[model samples]
Target: MSETSAGRAPEDAAGPAAPAGPPGAPAATLPYEAIRAIPVRHYGRWAAAVVVVALLGALAYGFSQGKIIWNTVGTKLFDHTVVTGVWHTVLISVCAMAMGLVLGVLFAVMRLSKNPVTGAVAWAYIWFFRGTPVYVQLLMWFNLSLIFQTINLMPFYKNDTVAVMTPFVAALLGLGLNEGAYMAEIVRAGIQSVDPGQTEAAHALGMTGAKTMRRIVLPQAMRVIIPPTGNEFINMLKTSSLVSVVQYSELLRATSDIGISSNAIMEMYFVASVWYLVLTSVFSVGQFYLERRFARGSQRSLPQTPWQKVRTNLTTLRRPKVAR
Candidate 1:
């Protein structure tokens, strides 16, 4: 080691090493820029900045209008339909998803069944549900009570010994059953996506067909299934509007009612658009993350993060490559 020439070696001897501070000193003097190196192109950062500016501009313009029509309309929606609409929408989505999943699994098995009767029945179900319009189905379900008069559900709805199906039940069945047809195909495709070797291996390991399906097949298939399932759920929420024809008092029905009663046709529709936009935006974001989670087992690599997705999208837009 070299030292300063107070009574010793010349300082020039220590030249190369002198600037090196103790490790603790460099750590203590952390560079803020290095610590915070957020890339400028990050999606959330740009989106946040854009949203803030847009919101501020809207607020300013709304105040300048003197009438505050946007606020008034916003207050009305919040006071009445928005919250309840969201709840009902979620309830319908959850119920429909559950019912659809069960039906889809059963239908998939039936489609793969050796028994001709079971396969035919499954095919007929898919044909009817997929061929017919969902709106018509909802109408049919609501009117089913007209044909059945009184249902003998044994004990579930046997309060009066003869219970009639309500509009809500009809709507649920309509949306759920119809959704199942589409989900059945998704389920079948997802199941088939797994390697056939996996099934054979499971059998060689003494696993029963059902055991192999449950343990090996379905688990692997989820990566294929979940993304589309999320899409269907979101679609279901939007499509549930058709239930309004049966007067089920869902979001669309309420909006129509308010519009007619309040004589604010255009405005009420605008209000409805706001609700739909909000729901779609929230669900889209959620679906994006859900898709990422499921992508882990996909043949392709794990999905890009939202920022990466945006960057890729922008890059594609610039190049305009045809997707295979």
Candidate 2:
């Protein structure tokens, strides 16, 4: 009995052994199962996509049934007169924008000046130009000869108002002056957006008012100024169409002439629209790049270009999915 007890004590000290499997069999292990998470189905998003696609299809079908002469549009799209008109439109828009920019900067400075006289003058100029319709201004400019027989600067130059106020000059003044009033407000807003501390710093550095404005403030303010300025320029391009009323041959006027002669007014209108779209799209791309360039110090990461966006999307689409 003593020998049997001693042998049991060793077994007790060792504790209960695990149950054995079949002879020579490997230890059993629970197989690892990865969690298969099912994504939530967005039925609402799918429904919205279907609705949008259906609406687009219906619109396309409707336009397809319209009486648009596509051949006429194609034929006259690149006609010599149409091309010339496009050139003139671009020229006038550029000239007017340049004039507006100069006047805007000048008046914007005046509007912010300490002098009551200068500020009032600037305010009055802006108020009058902004208040009047651009069409009326154009007509007034065109018919200036009726009011003043001559434009005289006795010491330097003098001319008959009719001769000096050609259709081109009249259109330029009308468009440019009106644009300046709008641009002045834009420039002033941009200038004000800059930190007052920046100006104080410039003053501390012994920079004169003019130098500080030109060298320090304007550069910084450009970030705010560029976006709206680009939009205004694009608008100017479209507004140049109104010059046709004054007999200045621009894209719209040229197209109208061709339309009258060819008896395809609607087609010409379509062609003009296409050209305008093309011009606007091209300028839009330029504006995007310009804005990106000015965004350097403001943003840690600049917005991606259209090409970069496309590449990123494609890469995401092509990436391999891990097996569940």
Tens digit per residue, CA lDDT, model 1, 62-152 = 7677543465466657746756766777788789889999999989979988899999999999999999999889888877755766666
Q: Who wins the TM-score comparison? A: 2
lDDT of 1 at 307: 88
How does model 1 score by TM-score? 0.71
How many pairs collide in each candidate, listed in order? 0, 0
Candidate topping lDDT: 2
Q: Where's the lowest-lDDT run of ten residues in candidate 2? A: 1-10
What would the per-residue lDDT of candidate 2 be over residues 228-314, giving only the tens digit for each residue? Answer: 999999999999999987789999999999999989999999889999999999999999999999999899999999999999989
lDDT of each: 0.78, 0.91
TM of each candidate vs. truth = 0.71, 0.86
